[model samples]
Target: MRSLFQTYVHGSISAVLGPFRRYLPAVVLLGLLATALEGIGIGLVIPLLDVVVSGGSDAQGFLPGLLVSFGETVPRETRGLLIGGAILALLSVKNIVVYANGLLQAWIYGQAGHRLRTALARKLTAMDASDLLSEPPSRMLNIISNESWRSADAVAAVMGIMVNATAALILLAFLMAMSWQLTLVVLLGIAAIQFAHERMSQHFAGLSKIITDQNRGLAGRMLHLVAAWRLIRLFGREDFEEDRFAQASDSVRLAALDLQKRQMAVAPITEIAHATLFMAVIFFAWSLGITFGTAAAFIILLYRLQPQVRQIQAGLAALRGWTGSLDEVQWLMTAAPAEPVTSGHLPAPALTRGLAFEQVSFHYAGAAADRPALHDATFEVPAGTSLAIIGRSGSGKSTMAHLLCRLLEPTSGQILVDGTPLSEIDRVDWLAHMAVASQELELFDGSVTDNIRYGAPEADETRVLEAARQADADEFIRSLPQGYDTGVGDRGLSLSAGQRQRIALARALVREPRLLIMDEATNAMDLLSERAALRILEHRRGKGTTLVISHHLSSITRCDRFIRLDRGRIVESGTTMDFNEEQLARMLRTTGT
Candidate 1:
């Protein structure tokens, strides 16, 4: 079980409040005003009952005395009516404040959720590629979409508890004014109930963790099922997949049910405890020879007080149940990598001398230390030169590209651009001068023009068309029903593989980058289209530096230089013309291509 203080002071709640801290003052003020108004309405009940029971003959309590003093100026027959009207007005004002407070809370809830989602997205963008790949996509998706909302809701629950606690204290003060002894007894009884309920907090927290784990598994399984539907059908494994999903779903259901059962039990236990306390107070009042009017008003106030206290208890339990989600959100925001990516303040210089890798070595986290991805390898591509990197699938070709892009920093040694260490240059300025089109193409759900001009949104239609023509994509794009306006489905699923690749190429080219990297960028195109794209690259040979990674021999035949990688080591490097037909055939055979 967690204490109320610990639950509210948890770091996750603070992180959730960071973005909306400015609006918190307004939220607190409205909550306080609403609570004060409610106390005033509850206090008015005393005078209303007194007016009814004694018919304006006597005024006993503080509120009753005040009403009596105010009524002296009015006629005796209308004193009760005047008190009743005052009660109605006070209740009306309290209701209005309550409504306004609800609106403010709703706004906070929505804005908090939005901020959390946006913050998580920005966090992902700032994270290293290796850090992101450490977790499954489904897990990240669940946190962004589902757990973010739960975390926001927990903050709202905390606010509700604060408001209820304030109202309960005000009512307690009123009860004490009426009779100190009765208020003390009632307070003692309520404290005992709260102490007993505290034991359930740990249980709720445990159940919440189990539910969170089950939800992550379920989400992962659903994504797998959707992505592998064709494989499942081909292998006749529909029943197997169904059973796996059912197990995940059932685990979530049972955990949620257990949590709900425990949560629902709290309300009943609190209600019974309060009911017994009410009867005891009634008997004590009788023994003390208390008046019926005084006792009735106190019991009415006590009855109202019970729910407010119960609400405080329930809110505490809710916060405990959400502890797991809060912890996840906090971890996502604060976790750092062993080798954090550092940004420099200096702007990157132009690549007049070109890029160089000086004995660079990189080992992915959790990989065997002895077998690095790229080991003690050094290379250079001069300005306006063309270089081809050819190797087998796992020969560290993509890893080299990633390092050059600064997506993954080298574990040892240095990468330099024009004699300056790459780490000393501003990442934004460096990346702005380079563009890459890899094997995987990512196109959003928009028109063809939108996808082509994605990186250069300010590019005019003329520039977009020129880039598309350079990538051999304009012909097919014009044949579509809406030409450049034709919609590309999610991830460009509406277009063929070749069309999608060409569009990606066009997107990269539209940036007019000084350095361009193509990693099997034209594998999906036909031989003729491939040749046409390569022609564009050849024409840019002396205008911009190009690094091509491919297994297709024809794609790199015209390169100024070549490097062959094998088992994370560069096995050969020389001018492209140095590789004769026999050597090229042997290299292809060794790589099994």
Candidate 2:
């Protein structure tokens, strides 16, 4: 709702252009040269017209009374030649200078946009998981793809408009010096019309925000549809999906229509204002019997003034709309996590001993009092030993794993690595020492080798193959048409669910973390594939810490000890041998494979 011409808008414009401060002088000089040339062209038209109209024996040779009545003292022939040549040269220079200014402004704009996107992306990527999860991907995508570029473009447009408008006003002032009465009438009339246009700009600015938000929503909806196309088709929900997307698209369309209507309304008003002002000027000039040169210059000045008025208004409106979009983008980038968070490489633990969760309690962000996800859950696993957590659905096993990973900090309690509390450790380094493979795997569109190497970017091809072999993915990968170079379609759609899981495991394994967490990592695998995966896990068990969260009782039997969670509490804890026949049956029944 703020005026784009306010002080803050000016300050922001200054800040956005600050980086290009060094180039300002060059750009301004170029603009000045162009403006000067334009002024010269307008002022030259009068004398040129007079010369063409005047006729004598000297006119065929050149001209007569060219300087006599034209307020110059040069000879007729020389004066005519000078006036003609100056007009042509000024016109040519004006165009060339204008072109140069355009290129300079464009380069500055592109650089500013690039800097914003690169800086934001670097910050977002390096942020800890807690910080990264604060906002949705759709919002981030919108800021990076559109808003940043929009800000840069608005900065450039506003600069160009300001320079040109100032020049036009200066020219108008010069014309007013010649005839104040005519200038006053034209200026006041134009001012009234511009004020009306400004009133309508408020509506367009509001619509701009809605349009941006809706377009972002539309993109999110389309992405969801594409992601779940298989399920939608199976359920015959094509029409349902289309309707939902249409609703979002329709919202965007309506907002655009509102802006378009306002813009259209502006066009006619501006045209009418220009026509009336011109007619009034001509009427006054004809009555006074103005000289040929004076009338010609006045008309040229009028032509120049109209465009400047229209552009200044349009540029002001766009600047407001762009600022609103920029605010949304800034909000998204600065969104806080559900809690305070920090990021960087964590300090290495002096002892490198095992991990411990001391009376840890965590509740979901928004949940009923009776429905805690993890409550008074105390547990510990020795370093380098594999621990399995087994529980039925809704038993908070995954929540426990998430807490361990620091994706969600415990509401009240402490998790320690060795002797140091996790909160004290630097986030990035702590996460680096751990790796996880969950039920859902996210794979990008890239070669198999590229995907595997993601876990350890510096890993060699040999290391990549070794990790794939460990996850039992190397064979299938090689059997594919391109082997390790085979492309994994978006989200690994080209691979089966089981294959995707294996590849995900390979990605994690390649990191060779001190602690590896697997939350239902083999859920999509067949019995044989599960067996192969367990062997791969066991093969590296003694070398590093492995924690598996699963519903499969058989899987935990291989673990040295198992913990069971119920209603956010660790209801039972003991070795597999400690389970009585009844207790064992109860566990199996609850899992109910």
lDDT of each: 0.80, 0.73
Best by TM-score: 1
Give candidate 2 misplaced runs (Cα > 4 Å).
1-18, 50-71, 127-134, 146-149, 284-290, 321-324, 336-347, 350-352, 359-377, 389-412, 426-428, 540-542, 561-577, 580-593
TM-score per prediction, in order, is 0.89, 0.85
**lDDT tens readout by residue for model 2, 503-586:** 999999999888888888888877866887678667756677788886665567666677877777887788767775567658
Q: Report the CA-based lDDT of candidate 1 relative to the real structure.
A: 0.80
Which residue pairs collide, candidate 2? 346-429
lDDT of 1 by residue, 444-514 (tens): 99999999999688999999999999899999999999999999998887888789989999999998988
Best by lDDT: 1
In model 2, what is the error at residue 2, expressed in angstroms? 2.6
